[model samples]
Target chain A: MALFATCLTDTFYPDTARAVVRLLERLGCTVDFPLGQTCCGQMHFNTGYREQAKPLAQRYAGVFAGYHAVVVPSGSCAGMVREFHPGLVGASPATTMTYELTEFLVDVLGVTDVGAYFPHRVTYHPTCHSLRMLGVGDRPLTLLRAVRGLDLVELPFAETCCGFGGTFAVKNAETSTAMLADKMRCVLDTGAEVVTAGDNSCLMHIGGGLSRVRAGVRPVHLAEILASTEEEPWAAIR
Target chain B: MGSNPVTWLGTPPFPKAAHAALGDSQLRANLRKATGTIRAKRAEAVAELSDWERLRRAGEAIKDDVLSRLDTYLERLERAVTERGGVVHWARDAAEANDTVLRLTREAGADEVVKVKSMATQEIGLNEALAAGGVHAIETDLAELIVQLGHDRPSHILVPAIHRNRAEIRDIFRRQMPSAPPWLSDKPVALTEAARRHLRRKFLSAKVAISGANFAVADTGSIVVVESEGNGRMCLTLPRTLITVMGLEKIVPTWRDLEVFLQLLPRSSTAERMNPYTSVWTGVTPGDGPQRFHLVLLDNGRTNALADPVGRQALRCIRCSACLNVCPVYERTGGQAYGSVYPGPIGAILAPQLVGDMHDAQAASLPYASSLCGACYEVCPVRINIPEVLVHLRAQATAAKGSRGPEALGMAAAGWVFADPKRYEAAQRAGSLARFLARDGWITRLPFPGSRWTASRDVPAPPAESFRMWWRRTRG
Candidate 1:
């Protein structure tokens, strides 16, 4: 299996990518990181540059063509590949092989318990793409519940977008911030030490707001929490 | 008078308009309260049916079949209505539709007409057109009446005064309605009673009435209007001459097909099993209802919209406003920011297409107003893939802007870099140089385009090494 660490995770949140590698290896699966992969063309495709996105989509298909399974840690990127690649580059073998981290863990591996440990009060926010696009329902929570020492509190209005809609945050910043403010309030209301989601893009927006306000709450990726164990504990990178 | 009233002239682009709307705390509060309440109720109402998904599929299929052969269904409808003692008028655009209605009102020799809250008439700016022709159009629906009385644009599809709370509404009534009681309170019943008493005289005295149909059954030549208030029934029955302006797309082939929409519309819109009033009329009825009836089938850029294979699905909208209620963007910015009568997720896709001018900056910006969260698509009764259509429209808007624009140049540059891993890694390493400006691992501010992001949210400084660099160093 190959790991498709999305462009956002590779640049600003490299540790989240590392966590995925660690978790997959620990689950007794050999994972390959394809060096030729850069992006899934989601940003370009979504922002009205379909012609520009074509090359990236082609690159994605070529780089991961023969892999038995391609595990993507981000739901939006996975959706871009599985749902949209057919329209852009036609149906490639890699498109069907690609799976979101939670989908791969639960459906492919058939394991809810990954033998992980995290001793913090954490709330789970279901990102819009993961919830609605990929339909990764309760799979992350199902895994979190089996973590030996973790408390998974439900986020109020967890289905709402965190408003980090790629260029949308830049183009329509005020409206984006208004949405982020509500998401931040919901995260704060949980009173949990950490807020976690499958997609780091949304986490970055939510965490950016929380960090700006000095809210003292950490926005951690689901991979980092699942990768943590008694022998190797996950520490805050920031 | 030559200028088209249908155009949202001088309205700023969506982002600029939304920026102003975001500052209005009162409007924000009203929108949040109303949409949130409806969102919950709609969810419960939809959940009651075990076969809701099946019904939604049927609705989509039925609408698709109608749109596939719209000309046939429309001709069949025209013939049926003509046989039943009604006049059918084909309007290629808003100007023609307005002219037809104005001529009809003039023929009736009535200066004033009562309306049943039709989006078609709103799209055509029919009232303004009539007023220009020395005729008056009185809105009879409570919300439409409030909007008309307040001299305000209709902000929502179902509830035009959704931006105004009860206190604001009371003020509008007190200041605008001459018939409103001096001691009227802000209570819900009081507001409705006031609007009812004010419109009753107009309903009794008006010789001509106008409406937009919810569904027009082709075989039966019947027009359906479903409403919570009974004003639609009064307008349909009381007037001597009735004129209905309908969009070309609001047609179903058979009466049986109407059952699927009847089940979907009310629950998805008002969160009720059935609306309080559903008035379905077939042409004219002598000595029973209106003596003369005119049906204006409006094209008004619908054919242009229907020409696009992907965007044509927007024509299937039942106007339930379920998408509007669940939309987070609409919940915050309110409807006026969209600069069209159709606002929220539906407007984001529909307005740009109906206008058919992506070069128009305001219409172009509509597609970008959404976050592409897919919330609207999930809630739509007719299953319009709003996010898909939004992105598709954005591509058209981008093409219309040409390649010389800043956004286009940036996108082209990024596309070049992303085409190869070597160029992408080089760009990432260069991006990490911004860390020199970082304080405590975050870039609090930046310039131009980046400033837009850092205006409200902090940006994380790029890591020292890209993931590929780390992977090679550790595993090599």
Candidate 2:
């Protein structure tokens, strides 16, 4: 498997990439990174910029053309591809079905545990695109259930926006902060040690709320959770 | 941005103060007091009805059924209205619709036209259009009058000038329109009396009136206009000639559908089980009501919106503005930012669809205007699931243009690696090597789309140790 290690994992949270890779390898699969890959153009595409986003999409289409299946860890980025591909092509085409990770695990690969184990109190934040866009109902949760010693609690208003749209916070700061305050309250209400979600945008927002108040809550990516296994020496192999 | 007249709804001019009152604080207070009170009342009133959910379901189902056969429903509405001695005119777009209304007013031989608070009129810039046609359209509703005299736009649907406070309104009434009585104070009673006197003469003498409909029952050919002020009743019935420009989506299957709407609209809108005035008329009455009636069922890109299955449900919106009141965005920008007469949550989803699926930039900007908070969905009298529609529209809009950016590149790259286990594992090795990139476990300054993320909030630095590294060391 070639890695699309999303820009967030590659540039900021590479450890999530390492976990995702080891989790996959523990399940007996090879991972590869297409070094030429870059960021998904969803940011520019969403902010009412059409002309600025085309070449990045073209670069993506050209670089990953023949791959059997492409998997994205972040639902928002995957949404930009699986959902926005036709928009990228500017026309409906016969070809366009890339998979987000949960989609890959459940639909293509048909596996839950990547030989992972984790012992901790964890709560999952159903990222916007992952829940509504990808419709990954319980796939990540199904994987979470497989881990040994996992204590998972449900977050309240689990469907609400964490108020971290790419530019929404900066553009509408007060409203964004107001929404974030509500989301953090919910995350804290669950009394879980860490918050987990597939999309980084949401985690970043929730984390900010937790950090701003120096609240005892932290957010973890789904990839980081999946990479935890007691049997496999994952990090050394990576 | 404000002058384009093509701006998406809820695109206010002010930033809502990173913590300030407003470049338009008057607008904010007006909206806050109005929306807050309405939202609370709506909750209370809706709670009184155990069947509210069922009613919402019924409304959704009826709207869905009507929209699926929009052509048929519209044709039926047009035919029924025309057969009853009312003239039925088809407007292809706003310009045509404006032209038709102006021509009708001209033919009526009326110099000034009285108006009810109609979104359709504001939707097409009817007052502005009437002015161009050399017609002075007098807004009789106190709020509408405030907006008119103040040279501002209507912010909220139910309360057109909800963006103004009493003092601001008093200032407008005192200065903008000379006809306003000098002693008129901004007190509710004084303002209402002053407006009544100023508009009473216009209502009794005006030969023509222009309005919009809240619901147009196709089966009975009845049109309903709900308002707090009795001005709609006067504008609707007093004039000899009456013209109503109703959107294609405003029709219900039958008068029985009114049972759900009459209950839902007011309480959901003003948080009252019933508003003060509700004017329902089928056609001209022999001795009472307007003698000459014209119903203009305007399409103007609605059919285009109805073509998208996932998006078509947005048409189910009853314009109750329940979604708007509970909406955080609408709570801040106060309808001006939307740049459209429609603002808030409903505007975010509806404007993109109504303006032809974001072929233009303003429409494209509309979808990004929401937090997908789902509060809009929870408060939607019809259960529109606005956030779902927003995501769907965002997809259609992007698909319409075809995007090529770091976001797309990122999805495709991630998509390929996650496809194979070996490659995913190898990528994990690279991940450990790249952990240094995120400093102190957080990445503050970002680039491009990611920068769009860091612009408002701080990104938590990556953990000093990967979960994988920690797990491997502790267990293995």
Candidate 3:
């Protein structure tokens, strides 16, 4: 299986890439990144710059030319590749194929867990793209269930958007803050110390809300949780 | 909002109402609050079902079948309605529909008509049309009355007065209702009674009522109005002349189709297992309900919309508020931004489809309204890929002869760059280099429509290195 460490994880959040790679390798897959790969053109496509999105599509197609399947850590990026790519290209043949991280971990790889352990009262925040766009329902939950000693408490309104819709946060800041407050209330309701999700974008929004409210809960990515075990930082404690 | 098109939100392809709506902050806030609540609730309700995708597919199939054979079902419905002693009127446009209803009211010798909360009526501006014909159309639904009396256009699809908080509602009731109790508080009960009192006499005395159908069942010649309150029942019954105006796309071929929509609509929109008061009326009877039943089938721009294969699928909309509830764009700016009777995700697609892509900022801006989030698609009772349709429309708008300069130039250059990988790599390298030169991580300034990108949010600067470059350095 090949992993597409999305531009975000590759650049700023490198630890997330390491965790994704580590978790996949433990699941017994030969993870590879075709060096020729670039961005998914999601930003351009979403911003109504369809023309700008096309090159990224062709570049992605060109880079992932011979790969069997491409998995990305983020549902948004993966959705851009899977749903938007063919759409942007529109009958122009492109060989690149992709799946969201949790989806590939559950669907193609058929492994719910990579034999990791994290004993904590944590809740899952379903990213907007993960829940609605990619429709990656329960694939992450299926993996989380396998973790040894993980409580996996459910977050209230887990499926509601945390209002960090790419440029939406700045575009409609007041309404965005209002929605984030509602999401925060739901998160705080679960009494879970940590909020886990498949995408970092959503995590950052929720984490920012937590920071603003000075809430005790922290946001963690699903990749990091899956990549942890008894020998790692998230191992069972005293 | 200005008289000229200079301050228009988009190119001169938008309808008038959308352009006007941009300036109304109170309406925007009301819409934002109402749509936000519904959108949140929809997610909660949808998540409970394990086979949501299957349900969406089923809904899509039912609506598609109905829309494809719409002519047949409509004919069957008209025949069934006539057989059951209900007069059927076919309207070619909003003018014809309103004229038909007003003429019928005059024929019935009724001066006033009680109204159900119907989006079609709003779309056609039926109340104002009736007023022009010297007929007073009184809205009986709680939220609608607030909007009607306040002289406000509805923001959200489901809760028309969604923009109003309880206190604002109380103020509207206190100021507008002649029979209002002087101590009407912001409490829900107080507000309800105030509206009830204001509308009670209208419902009892009004000899005619105009409504829009949630679904027009062709098999049974039935018109269904799904709502949370019983006020619809008052509008459906009581009046001697009950006229149900419907969009041509509101038909379902059979009871099985109704079954699929029933499951999808309520869950997707109001977050209920089923609508509380789903009044199903099929023509008239000896002494039951209305003595005079009239069904007006409205085809205002629907056939034109249907002619386009890609866009015609939007006709399958069940008027379920589900799409409105789950939309992020709707959650923010609220439903008023689309500047049509229809707002939110459906409005973005449907407004352009129902009304011709007009010349103004509102109509032109409607296609680009969404972030292409696809939440509306997920929540739609009928599985309309709203995002796909939006993108398609945007492309259409962009490709039109009137394409704007900045967008056209950018898209043209993009077409060349995107058509090749090596060219894309060069562009990315150039972009990254430009970002380095700019120093500031986010681009605060932009040129023209690119200015819209920087209008609110930071244009995330190109990173120091493209992922491909980093991959090459590490892998090589």
TM-score of every model?
0.99, 0.72, 0.80
For candidate 3, write residues A106-215 as lDDT tens digits.
Answer: 88888876798888888998887888778898888888889888897888767777877764454344445556777888889988988999887777677766764558
Weakest 10 consecutive residues of candidate 1 chain B by summed lDDT? B1-10
Residue lDDT tens for model 1, B196-279 = 889899999999999999999999899999998889899999999999999999999999998999999999999999888999
TM-score: which is higher, 2 or 3? 3
Task: Please state the error at residue B306 of candidate 3 in Å.
Answer: 1.9
Q: What's the chain B TM-score of candidate 3?
A: 0.88
**Winner by DockQ between candidate 3 and candidate 1:** 1
Candidate 1's displacement at residue A196, Å, is: 0.7
Show the lowest summed lDDT stretch of 10 residues, model 2 chain B: B12-21
Put the candidates in TM-score order, highest first: 1, 3, 2
lDDT of 3 by residue, B1-476 (tens): 22211122332433333334445577567665666666668778778888888888887887777777778888998898899899999998888888898899999998888999988888887887788889888988888999887887677677887778888888888888889877889999878877777788888898888888988878788888889889999888888888899888888887767777787888887888778898888889888999899898888888987887878878878777777766655655556556667877787788877656535445656776654557777667777778777766766665553446664665567656655557766877676654643333445555655453343333435666655555567664
Pairs of residues clashing in candidate 1 = none
* Candidate 3 stretches greater than 4 Å from native: A1-32, A39-62, A84-97, A106-125, A138-158, A162-238, B1-57, B255-257, B267-276, B287-289, B401-404, B411-467
Off by over 4 Å in 2: A1-161, A165-178, A181-203, A209-238, B1-33, B179-185, B405-440, B464-476
C-alpha RMSD over true interface residues, model 2: 6.9
